[model samples]
Target: MNKKSLSQQIYEARWCYLFVLPCSILTGMFVLYPIGMSWYFSLLDWSGFTKDAKFIGLQNYAEAINDPFFWNAFSRSFIFMFGTVPVKIILGFVIAVFLNNQVLKLSPFFRTIIFMPVVTAIAIIGIVMTFIFSPFNGPANKFLMATNLTSGPIDFLGNPDTVLPTVMGVYVWKWLGITMMYWLAALQTVPQDVYDAAKIDGAQGYRLWIHIILPIVLPFAIVIILVEAVSALNVFPLIETMTAGGPFFSSEVMEVYIFRTAFVTDAGTMPRLGYACAAGVFWGVAVLFITALQGFWMRRTRRI
Candidate 1:
């Protein structure tokens, strides 16, 4: 058997390359171009309104590093990620396990019910949630009052103290089903014979899960957690529609901060497109670092 030359291999795979050309072009135009432009813009001092963009290297980044509001938004993003990722992982795992049980009737229906929110528009959900948690004439407040849980109507989306947590809850509820699906896929990888063998060895209930099931699913859990953590940083739509980072900017995350800086010009303020791009670049780097860390951990786990 003769080994094919590079030219021959290229010729043979020409059709495959032809098929991928359109998608590659689209990605280059839409994704790569924007990302490259963002980095370039980050190095400038521009208001996005005029062509007078002065090239200022690292000044925007230095400003961002010292900006209190930027740090506040950054910290809030981490808080949201920390608060929601664990709950989503744990609850999603449990629900997936419950749904995976052979004795569970109408599991498909239950799954559909749980996953319905995932497909629903986030904007729509945000609007509905605001109404539901409205201080006056809302069902949530009405129920709370009826049950005497609170003395007055609670402003869920209005109060800074409760707004972050409220949005986190809604975020968890909206995306929990996706986490469940990940767990379900992981669970399917465990062979039934292994379960039967473990059962025969008296490893039942929690013991079986602790020793056998967990070990099998640990790898999957790592990936799922990383995905959820990254996803938690992308709560712009939900937060935008629900809170608009209001109530004293309690719910303002990095994306909202960037948007406000780049586009939303107040009475006397100019839209700092360059500064916003710097913030965005910083955020992108942070996400890359996190992903790299997770990848390192994954490799280490595999070695162990």
Candidate 2:
């Protein structure tokens, strides 16, 4: 209300601005600008790389809805998300319990081993997995062949049935470590006496975990689930690099589909920025929907 009060408030807030300025600028430049640009471009029939254009109102969005490829890619993404998130959460928790125990020596080393892939270049791993999953002469198939386990070679990325699952495998492999590390941090706070008391009550294994530990870790687990769901939805580079959603476009995610539509294909066929934005808007809505449902689930489960 007073000048001095206002001045003091402004003075205090000055450092807040100083601290936040860089992040704000970066968000504006990269995030806000691109979103606005994408929305603007989405309204046009602009070839992503060229100057030729037309203003198509709702046409692209209309086409995107009826497009079979859009729905197919979305379905594959859902499959990938369903496959990876549960396995990652369960395995990560189990691994975190082991890593957090005081009895373990070289805990940091083990932690690093689990988390190494998270830091490793995704592009490089894509190339490596491509070779490993190669039907012929790849080590994976070769090992299976060596063991007399059925056929000579099984197509991992090439086969329609297997491609989505293979990508899901890669998704879990890469993401599990990060989730495990989060669990390990949460594990440290779980009082040791709780486990001892559970043992005294004759509880062990799954019973102890279900009744005691998992509940304590519920918040972290929920956070990880929400983040993973959002990240998994946006997965594109690996989809592009690895499968290209090939074998009749079985694994093409929405992001990859949009990228190809906007930039790769010529305007003569499918350079539909508006369609891509519509796809993005639809995906964004789906993400929000899932997140909302997850939040509701967390609240419901938390009460129990």
Candidate 3:
């Protein structure tokens, strides 16, 4: 016989609010606070740790627009995306097909072996890769020398011409298992009757995959592309530990660039927290833009 006010309704649901309050508070503290602080910092000239955050208005953004190195790093992020994403998607899909094969016994064991690298530490992977690609006595070099491919070690990761591609190869190798799992999960969702019908229609092997399976898994492929695209832009630790963005910054990506600008400047130079925050903000906006484009394209494709 009575209507409750919004406050009264909330009061009645206090326990539900209490249940979600911790998560909300944590999100505000970690996510929202950092974003707000970063945006504020982007407008100031401060060393990240110091209290002297002098407001500089939009000077940081202005500097970023003219900064050649920043633009180079931005371009390199896209290069890294292009170098890794397609290869990983194609190779992962192929591996998923092999693993999903009905005749393949011990598929689980192979899958476990392949996926081990996904759980491995990037630092460890980089270190191991460094040793493996070492010119002196690395296994790869040894194999090459033994096979008479060259007179000596090729310096795969040490050469500027090769380092980015080498890093891409290692990145693809480490993450392929996870991508394979995504594809495999998508593949498993396809109906058995669909395969039966395809087989009855004389579609076999590659034809069945191309005609039927691919259409079914296109959505999963889009998800994988979006995920890997964002991730590939943020590549740092692998490039850090493996190459240190060196061979003269040939492998420097957005994250590595942000870190170097923020904290790892020349010996006498103070950290440019504001400038780095601007760079970070720019990267965040760029990623959001790219992801938005991906979402739009996916929606458009579905409409078609």
Off-target runs (Cα >4 Å) in candidate 3 are 1-5
Residue 183 accuracy (lDDT) in model 1:
95
* Candidate 1 lDDT, 154-219, residue by residue in tens: 999899999999999999999999999999999999999999999999998789999999999999
Tens-digit lDDT track of model 3 for 53-143? 8999999999998998899889988999998999988999889988998788999999999999999998899999999999889999999
Candidate 1, residue 167: Cα displacement in angstroms equals: 0.4
The model with the greatest lDDT is: 1
Tell me how candidate 3 scores on lDDT.
0.90
Ranked candidates, highest lDDT first: 1, 3, 2
- Give residue 196's lDDT in candidate 1 (0 to 100): 95
Model 3: ten consecutive residues of lowest lDDT = 228-237
The global C-alpha lDDT for each of the candidates, from Candidate 1 onward, is 0.94, 0.81, 0.90
Which 10-residue span in candidate 1 carries the lowest summed lDDT? 100-109
Write the residue-wise lDDT of candidate 2 on 114-214 in tens digits.
89889877777778889989997898899989898947699999998888888888878877888898888888778889989999999998999889987
Please report how far candidate 3 places residue 204 from its true position, in Å.
2.8
Which of candidates 1 and 2 is the stronger one according to lDDT?
1
Best-fitting candidate, scored by TM-score: 1
